[model samples]
Target chain A: MNVLYFAWVRERIGVPSESVETQAATVNDLVEELRAREDRYAAAFADTSALRVAVDQELTDFDAPLAGVKEVAFFPPMTGG
Target chain B: MRIIVQEAPFDFGQQAQAFASGRQNMGAIVTFTGVVRDDASGALTAMEIEHYPGMTEAALTAIANDACARWSLGDVLILHRYGRLTPGEMIMMVATAARHRRDAFEAAEFLMDYLKSRAPFWKREVTAEGASWVAAKDEDEAALDRW
Candidate 1:
């Protein structure tokens, strides 16, 4: 699956996107998997409240099922106008 | 419906004129422009807007579609720019046309409120103090409740 980070999350993770080979079943599971990878991931995933998630480009909750999901994006709350 | 997500600067006057013209069926057209503003410290150098390439277009289209469904709109136009922009530069614009002024105005406000929180765009304020992400306000999320 392709995992993307945006804005400060991208800065903290030091990359915009990456291919993650995971056996996670849910978004939270995926976050935990990433958090266990390194310090940067841990720091970025430290607080899920400050972040928003999208699965296959649709806004969803952290506990959303990841079945058949090809992409996931994590970013701070949108500030668009 | 016209949705444009580009990095180029748009001519507000020309765009507004084009949207209003040829809409004899519609009696009212409402257009709103958002401009970048300097930080309170007065050290804003530039504002950088980052957005999900594919998802941004999809999101805006969905919002415009919903607005059309909720109102008696003749047409809708959304133009948002990404990349670095200076203070006072136009960041984005939304226009709606309807047979009545109330519908046009309400639909335009609906578009603005939804785009403020739901769109996949993030704004970064670059100032002499340093660059920082603009925090999403609780009021922005609450604004959606009116609709």
Candidate 2:
């Protein structure tokens, strides 16, 4: 799956997107895998409450199933108008 | 319905005129433009807007379609700009056309409300001190509950 980040999350993670090989079944499980990878990932995922998730470009919760998902994006709450 | 997500500046007046013209059945047209506001400190330099390339258009289209489904709208136009924008520049605009003013006005408002929180765009305000991401306001989220 391809994992993406935006805004401050991207800044903290030091990359916009990455291809990840994971056995996670849900968004939360994927976050855990990434968070355990490095300190930067841990710092970015340190406080999930300040973050939002989208699976396959659709807004969804962290607990959303990642079955057959191709992309996952994490970012701050949108501030557009 | 038209949805445009671009990095270049758009001519609001031209777009507004074009959207309102040649519409005999639509009696009313309401357009709203959002500007990049400078901070009170006056040290702000630019507003950098970041958005997901594929999801931005999809999200805006879905929101506009929802407005059309809920209201008696003739047409809907949404234009949002990304990249570095200086203060006083236009950030985005939404125009709604309907047979009645009520529908046009309400639908335009609905588009604005949803575009604010639901869209995938994020804004970072650049100032002399530093650049920081704009935090989403609680009121913006609460505003959606009224609809």
Candidate 3:
């Protein structure tokens, strides 16, 4: 699956986008998997309280299922005027 | 109800005039423009906006539709420009028309909030130091919660 980052989220993660092979079943599970990888992922996922997720272009919660999801985007809320 | 996503510049006066001309009973017109900032507090210098082709359009269309459904809006126009944009460049514009000022103002504000938090565009900025991606802000998402 492809995971994308935006704004400061990309900076914290060290990459704008990445394709990872995972065995996660839900968005929260994926976050946990990434958190296990290293410090960068841990920092990015450190405060899931401040982050928002979208799966396959639809806004969803972290606990949402990602069984067949192709893309997952995580970012701070949004600040567009 | 027109939605445009392009990299070109637009004329707000012309757009507002056209919208007003078409509506005989509209009493208010509200518009909002988002400009590209010269700096993103060191995160970005020059910025490029990337979006999911079909998904971007669909998401924006749905936002505009949602605005129309919630308000007594007469017409709505949303234009977001992508690609590489310089500082002070216009990033997007949203205009709304309604029979009353309150409805027009609230709808316009609501539409902008929704687009900011829900749109699929990703922005990467370049500076003299290096290039980095911009992250969404918590405040931006919180703004929509009021509506």
Alpha-carbon lDDT, every model: 0.96, 0.96, 0.82
TM-score on B-chain, cand. 2: 0.98
Order the numbered candidates by DockQ, best leading. Answer: 2, 1, 3
TM-score of each: 0.98, 0.99, 0.76
Worst 10 residues of 2 chain A by lDDT: A22-31
lDDT of 1 by residue, B20-122 (tens): 9986789999999999987574689999999999999999999999999999999999999999999999999999999999999999999999999999999
By TM-score, the better pick of 2 and 3 is: 2
TM-score (0 to 1) of chain B for each candidate = 0.98, 0.98, 0.91
DockQ of each: 0.91, 0.93, 0.33
Worst 10-residue lDDT window, candidate 3 chain B = B38-47
Across residues B102-140, which tens digit of lDDT does each residue of candidate 3 receive?
999999989888887688777777788877667777688
Each model's total of backbone clashes: 0, 0, 7
> In model 1, what is the error at residue A69, expressed in angstroms?
1.0
Q: Which segments of candidate 1 are over 4 A away from where they belong?
A: B39-41
Candidate 3, position B52, lDDT = 55
- Find the candidate with the highest TM-score and give its number: 2
Candidate 1 residue-wise lDDT, A1-81, digit = tens: 999999999999999999999889999999999999999999999999999999999899999999889999999999999
